[model samples]
Target chain A: MDWPTFIQSISNAVILGSIYATVAVGLALAFGVMQMANFAHGEFFMAGAYVVYVFYAIGGMPFPAAVLSAFPIVAALGIVTERFIFRPTRGNVLAGFMATAGVAFVLQVIVGQVWGVGLMRSVPTPYMGAAEILGAKVSWQRLLILPATVTMVGGLWFFLHKVRLGKGLRACAQDVEAASLQGININKMTALSMAISGGFAGIAGALMAPINAVTPYMGHSIIVTAFIVVIVGGMASIEGSILAAFILGFIHTFVTTIFDAVLATMVGVAFMAVILVVKPSGLLGRARV
Target chain B: MKYLAALAGLAGFILLPHFIGEYYVEIMILFMINLILASSFRLITTVGDWSLSHIVFMGVGAYTTALLAKYLGWPFWGTVLIGGMASAAVGLAVVFPLLRTKGFGFFIGSFALGEFIRLIWVKFHFPFGGPRGMIGIPSIELGDIDFYEATPYYYLVFIFTVLCQVVLYRIDLSRTGRVLKAIYADEDLSKCIGINVARYRAMAFSVSAFFAGIAGVLLAHRLGAIDPKNFDVNTMVYLVIWVVVGGVGTFWGPIIGVAIMMVIGEAARPLAEWRPLLFGGILIVFLTLLPGGLENLILRFKEMLEKLRSAGESQPAE
Candidate 1:
């Protein structure tokens, strides 16, 4: 490949990796704290994209405002889901899975009903120009995602490390009974985790709305990819999830560019199989009894 | 009395094709095939481990049967047996390494493994017919009688379903079944008591895979096509739902679950747009209200009836 084309591929890989990281980090958080895999997580991301699509495309609201609006809306939905669904299904893994799976299907059907499932929604790009950096062309819209993701992830890191409530959240994730004994409300921590996680997914969806086709079934592929990333990383590990997401993102993007999407998917799945065969617990996962 | 009930049920099943219409007969055959799938899924769950890739075993069987029959010109029946054995062999080879991991690790591991197999199906078109899927699968034939019609296929499916159920029923009541139950209750304790937990779990999975393969072969013949999309995650999810809704621990639970689900699916066909939403709602309601599943409800009701009978006997004068 030429230098410029190679640079473009790298840029695409980085952008895609950032989105994957954003989407998966929330799932890692929820799994870490609750020991439940939120199967409807990608739906939250889809909902966020729709939020932006409705506000900006249909209502003519500014893109930035629509993006900002999705965070709170999706976060509220997350809290409600935690309170109603996850709380009741506590300690019942199968129930939680079924409930989430049901939620995913419900959300998809609702979206399909609202927006006709025939054609994909087109979200207009807020920034339409491209930048030339050392003979490599990068679209402003694509570049914006990098900074937005960095800010969100950085803020999340700060919240988890530097804040008291964040420390309680971590403590609760580590040991619910002990954290409760120490006066940390397990319910509140769980709600908080879901809120943050859902908001992150929504924002990721909002950012990608311009670049990718927005459809109800979009979550299907996204969730599967997230599952693969989460497993390749240690489940419940935020750092591990981010690292794995980028690794997979690069692998998928680079392969797709060189070969075809079908072959790329095959290669990615093969990589996961080989990893499972070798490590089993995953690269960074600690053995849990 | 039990023997009489079994004989009557068998006779009814055998004579079903004569009374039902062709379309209805097809549905019943599909139900029989699904029963095998769901029962095998339950068998695997006996070891306290649930696999999302259970349907992939079906895919393995379907693809194996389709390819061998199409390319090698093998007899349909021979291919069916070969396909099932192939699935069993693959199950045995992977079960040891897979069962070594537990919890969500095993769950995700099997899922990836399944997807990997599917990718191979899509990538290697020469052998497995890629994304377009293989079509025009030859139908099974008996001596001087082609089983191409609905009646013959229905009878074939009914016989296999009964045979599979009989085998599974025997296994469920055997010494190995007892060991599997013990492992499910307390794996560490079962190991301490000299039960080979891993070996038994692998055995259960292999048996489950074997039946699943048989079901797959039947499904391929019924549809006359096999595609990569047939064994995707969505199909796997539905299979898991069938097992869960039917009651994982009960042998007959999945039978009831699959029958109900298939009926619901057919009934919901008119509601095309709203069907998925309705299906999701049903799942949620079942999860919240009937968490132990339909079988549990029946068991509880039976227990209540027994208690009422005893109470009436005790109150003699009243």
Candidate 2:
């Protein structure tokens, strides 16, 4: 590849990595705090994009404001999913996880019915100009994702490390029985973890609204990628997800540049399969005692 | 008395196809295929592993049959057996990487592997026929008997379904099935004993996939076409829903679940796009409130009846 093309691929990979990090971080957090593997996380991301479409494009709100709006709205959705679906089916992790597939179906049908599922909704590019770096031209809309991801992920790091509730969540993730006995509200932590999970996924979706086609079924594709990322990063390890997301993003972007999207996906999945075989605990995840 | 009920049910299956319209007959054929699919799925779950790629193994059987028929001109008998073996081989390969992971890890890993296989079909247009899938698959024929019509095909599927069900039922009753159940009950304890957990788990998975492949081949020949999309995750989720809603504890649970859901699906035809919403609702409700499924409900009723009968007998003696 030429210098410009190589640089462009690098920039694109970074943007792709940012979006993936934002999406997979929430999934990792939820899985870590509780064994709640949400099959509907991609839908949460899709819901975020729609939030942007509604508030910024249709409602004529500021793009940033609309993107910001996605966090709380979809976070509420995460809380509801926890309170109803995950809570009732708490003891059996797989059952709760499978129930989210039902949630995915319901969300898809509702979105399809409410919005015209025919043509993919094109959210207008809020930031139009391209930024040049190392002789590679990148769109401002895409570049914005890097800073946004860093901020969101950085914020999450801070929250988890410094906040009392965040410590409670970590404690629960470590040992539910011990955490509960120590006067931590397990219910509150699970709900909070899901809320943060939903919020991160929502923002990721909002960021990509203009970059990709917004459709109800869009979640179907990314959910596979997200699962691959989560597994490779280690099921519940946020840092691992971030690292794996970038690795996968680079793999996806470079492979797509060289070959096609299909081949890129195959390679990514192959990488994940190798990871599962070599290190089941993940890159950063601690093995269970 | 149980034999009489079984005989009557078998007779109804045979005779009912003749009475039903062509469309309903086709539905029955599909239903019987699903019955095999769901029950075989139950076989794997007996070992406490829920593979999200069960449907893809069905696709393995399907694409195998399609390729064999299209190129080699293999007849239905040859293709069905080969398709099943191919599916079993693929299932074993998938479970090989998966035996280390448990619960959610296994589920996600299986999905990734399944998607990898499915993508191979979508990427290569040479034999698998890309996204549009394969078309114009040759239908089954037995010299004078052309199995194109609804009734003949229905009977064919019925025969396969009954055979598969009997074999599966026997396995469930055998020492092997007990070993599988023991693994599900407590993996550590089972391992501490002489039970080979990984080997049994792998066996159950491949065997289950073997039957799923048969179902896929039967469906493929009936439809006279095949595609990658037909064996995607959505179909797998439906299978999961069927097994969950029906209860996988017993041999008949998933079958009953499929029967009930298929009927509801047929009735909900008017709902059109809204059908998934109903299904989704049913899945959540069943998983949360009725985790044991329809079979669990029936088992409860049977227990109640037994309790009442024994009480009456003792009261009369007193």
Candidate 3:
């Protein structure tokens, strides 16, 4: 293609990849530690966006403060779900995951009922104008996502490596029984992972609130993509999710630009199938599932 | 007594359409179709698989029948057979890559693969007709009895339903069914006993898809229209709700689940928008509190009745 279009596509790809990474990393972390998969993860992302809507747009808070509010609000949601749903259904991965469908339905209804489901909520663009790069103008709203992703993902990396609780999470993921014997509270680690997962997903949603049409049903599409990313990245590997996120983000953005959005999703799904077949353990995954 | 109950139930089914309004008659047709779908889905569950692609395979059957009837002017019988076979082929393709994975991986893999097939329909407008899907499908015409009539069409679906159930029921009772149950109970032990684990899993999945196709064919002909939305993830969730609430251990479980859910669904038609919320709540409650589902509830009642009877007999002897 032409130079400007190519440049725009590349930037778009990066932005998309970063958003995907933020959403997917949480999924991988929760799954890695507890083998607990949340089918309503897209709803977690939706809760994040709604957090910004309630805090920033309606409550008159600054954009940064609203975005920050999304994390704790949605993180609390995650912890609640873990304690009530995941903890009780522990060991039966299918039951816990399937039950999340109930969680999704409940969340959607609650959001829709409160917001009035008839019309989509429009959060005005907080950051006006675009940042020109290589003759291609990228909106400031979009450009903000890349750094936000790197910081969050990088922060997660440091926490996992440097922090004692994070290291305990890794230990729990590697072997829960062994980690518990070594004095790590299994329940605490699982709850922590879910909180982080919910927080990141919420952050991604908060960041995109202005760009996307904020509706109760918005999570439907994103959940499909998140699942594909988590699967391709290896079910529970954070590193694999990040790597898979970029790969999928680039694939989705480029394909949509070249062809159409629907076909791009098809291509992205086909890409996931290939990844599953080629590297069942995922790119950086150690766990088989 | 059981045989008499079966005969009476059959008589009710045959005659009830005459007494009901056209709307209720149509709903019964759909209820029957869902019964087949739920039962076939339970077949896969028998092998301990909870695939999210079951509805997609049903869509395959619907699309196949729609196209074959629309373009080629094929007869109803021929198109239905082609529909089942086509879904079976697609089912095999989906089950292939998923053979290596089990449990959660298999569940997600099947979902991704199912979505891929659906995307093909949504992306290409050639024969599949993209998102809007196909329309104006010809109803099954057998001599003078037109299937466009609600009563006639009910009988048409009824026959197919019985046939599909018979096959499914026989399979569940046969040696093959026993082996599949064994596999679900303990896959490693079944493998140790020289059972081809992948082969059986793949076979059960495809066979399940085959019956789902039969249901799809009935749906396409009845509705005379089909769309991508007809077989989506939400629809799949509803399918899961039906199976989970009914319990999957027994053949009749899905049937009971469908019956109870369909009744609830119909009764809640006024609160249509809130029904998903209700069903979702029901799913979580049933899973957490009543893991064995409605069938388990019935089985427990039976045991209690038998114990009461034995107690009465012992007291009288004493």
Candidate 4:
């Protein structure tokens, strides 16, 4: 590949990695805190995109404002899911996880019914300029994702390390009984974790809405990618998720550049499978007893 | 009494198509195909590993038969057998690496592998027809019987369903099935007892995939066309919903689940775009409130009836 193309690919990889981190981080958080693995996380991401579509595209709200709004909207969805779906099925982790598939279906149908499922909804890009970095030209909209991800992930790190409630969530993840005994409400922590998970996924979707086609079933492909990221990152390790997400993003982009999207996805899955065999706990995940 | 109910149900299945319209007969065929799919899925779950690839295995079978029959002009019976074997082989390969993890890890890993296999079909247009899928698949031809007719096809599926169910039921009742159940109940304990946990788990997965392939074969011929989209994760999730809603604890649970859901599905035809929402709602309800599924409800009802009978008998004695 030429220098310009290589630079372009590297920039694209960064953008892809940012999006994957944003989507997978919440999944890792939710799983860490509550063992509540959401199968509908992609749907949550899709809902976030639709939030941007409905607010910025249709309602004529400012793009940044609409994107910001996805956090609360999808976070509320996460909380509701935790209460109704995750809470009741908590004892059986698999059941709780699988039930989210039902949630995914419900969300897809609801969104499809309301917004019309036949064609993809195109959210017009508000930032419509390209920037020259090195020799490669990258879109401003795509570059915006890098700072947004860094800020969100950085802010999350601060919250988990500094904030009392975030510490409670971490404690709950480490030992539910101990955390509960120590006066942490497990329910609240789980809910909070899910909220953050939803919020992160939502913002990722909102940012991508203008770039990706908006569809009800769009969650299908993304959920697969998120699951791969979560598994490869170490099922419950937030740092691992971020690292794996970028690694997968690079793998996906470079492989796609070399071959095709289908082969790239296949390569991604193969990479995940190999990782699973070598380090089942993930690249940086601690082994669970 | 159980034998009598089974006989009557069998008789009803044989005669129903004669009375119903051709469209309904076709629906019944699809229902039976799903019955095989769900029951085989329950087989894997007996080992406590719920695969998201069972439907994809069906796709494997369909595509296998589609390629062989279309290109090589293989006969129906030969294609079906090969399809089952092909799916089992693929299932073994997929489950091989998955042996390292359990629960959530296995679930996600299987999905990735399943998607990988599916993308192969989507990526290759030379033989698999890419995303558009294959059409003009030749219908079954056996001994001068017009297999294209609804009745013949229904009977064909019925025979396969009964045969598959009987074998699966026998397996469930067999020692192998017990060992699988033991693995699910306590893996460590099963290992201590000299059970080859990995071997049995692999066996169950392959067998399940084998049956799923058969269902796919039946479906491919019925539709006379196959698409990559037909075997996607959405279909797999629907299978999960069936097994979950029906409860895979017993051999008959998935059968009952498939029957009830199929009926609900047919009845909800008027709902059209809203149908998936209702089914999704049912899945959530069953998982949250009735996690043991309708089978648990039936078992509870049976226990309640027995309690009522004993209570009446004691009252009379008193």
lDDT measured at residue B117 in model 4 versus the true structure, 0 to 100: 92
lDDT of 3 at A12: 92
Q: To one decimal, what is the Cα RMSD in angstroms of model 2 from the true structure?
A: 1.4
- Model 3 / residue B261 / CA error / Å: 0.5
* Model 2 misplaced regions, further than 4 Å: B308-318
Query: What are the runs in model 3 whose C-alpha is more than 4 Å off?
Result: B305-318
Computed on C-alpha atoms, the DockQ of candidate 1 is: 0.58
**Clash list (residue pairs), candidate 3:** none
The 10 consecutive residues of candidate 4 chain A with the worst lDDT sum are: A280-289
lDDT: the better of candidates 1 and 2? 2
Candidate 1: which docking quality band? medium
| Per-residue lDDT of candidate 2, residues A1-289 (tens digit) | 8899999999999989889999999999999998888989999999999999999999999999999999999999999999989999998888998999999999999999998788999999999999999999999999999999999999999988999988898999889999999999999999999999999989989999999999998888888889889888888899999999999999999999999998999999888888887898888888620
Q: Give the poorly placed runs of model 4, Cα more than 4 Å off.
A: none
| Model 3 chain A lowest lDDT segment of ten | A271-280
Model 1 lDDT tens row, A1-289: 7888788888888888899899989988888888767888889999999999999989999999999999999899789778877888888765776678888888899999999787999999889999887787889998998999899889989999999999998998888899999999899999999999899989988888998899988888888888778777877888888898899889988899888888777777667766666776566876431
Could you give candidate 4's per-residue lDDT for residues A144-191 as a string of tens digits? 999999999999999999999999999998989999999998999999
Error of 1 at B19 (Å): 2.3
Clashing pairs in 1: none
Cα lDDT, model 3, residue A281: 82
**Per-residue lDDT for A264 in model 3?**
92
TM-score per model over all chains: 0.96, 0.98, 0.98, 0.98
lDDT of 1: 0.84
